[model samples]
Each structure stands twice: as C-alpha cells, then as structure tokens.
Target: MYCAELGISYEIVPTKFDEVKKRPFTDINPNGRCPGAIIQYIIEQYDTEKTLTYNTLQERHHLKQWLQFQMSG
Candidate 1:
C-alpha cells in the first residue's frame, strides 16, 4: 500500500517465519528479521525518489520514531 503510493512496485515473497530463517531469505537479510529489514530494503531499493518514505531529514526522523512505535507499541 505505501509502496504503491510512492509509485513503486513491491514484489511479494510469501513465506512463513521458519522459511524466512532459511537460505534464500538469509541471502536477503542475514539477521532474518523479516519485515523490518526487508521492508526497509524494499523502500530503499524501490523508492528511488524518497516518496512512500520520508523525503527530508525531519521526515526521516519522524518515520524512524513512527517505526519504533509501530514495532513496539
């Protein structure tokens, strides 16, 4: 949804958590912390214009804070 807002195409790789801990997923993220690192990777790789994400430093900081809330709270 967010990626689409940024005009980026997100390719979904449907896999369970156990599968994510395996070989191919590890190649994408060694730590295997599924959506956190993976979504960040996708945003970085695909949101070339900084759309779907923060376009400025202040916005980036806000996004970081929001992510913390999202992941924890």
Candidate 2:
C-alpha cells in the first residue's frame, strides 16, 4: 500500500514454499524466510526507476524512515 501511495507499481506473486519445511534458524532472520525472500526477489526484479520524483538524499532518507516505521509498527 505504501508503494502504491508513492506511485510505485508492485505485484504479489503466488508462492509454493511449504512453511513446515522452514525451521527455527530460517525464521530468525526475516530476509532469510520464504516470504521475505519472495519480497526481495520481486523488489529487485521490478525496481526500474532511478528516481522517485528526482532522487534527493533527504527525500530518500525520509522515505526509508517512513518505511521502517510502517514495517516496525
């Protein structure tokens, strides 16, 4: 939804990874988990924009902080 608000096009892909197969260690790091991996994959594959309304450091940092707040809470 944040991406949508930022005018970034995104899609959710179907996954077939069995959650049962992913154990304790795998779940420790969010990025190491299946769902996280899928998200990373999609982000890498889909992000083609070099700038979001012109890439300024302050604007980028604000966006990053906003995303952190959204994800953490």
lDDT of each: 0.70, 0.50
Model 2 agreement with the true structure over 1-55: per-residue lDDT tens digits? 3356446677866555654245653666544333334333444455456423226
Error of 2 at 26 (Å): 7.0
Model 1, 1-73: lDDT tens digits are 6666767666876778688678987898775554565467767888887666877899878877776666553
Superposed model 2: Cα runs more than 4 Å off: 1-45, 50-54
- TM-score per candidate, chains pooled: 0.51, 0.38
Residue 17, candidate 2: C-alpha displacement in angstroms? 18
Tell how far residue 23 is off in model 1, in angstroms: 14
Q: How many backbone clashes does candidate 2 have?
A: 0
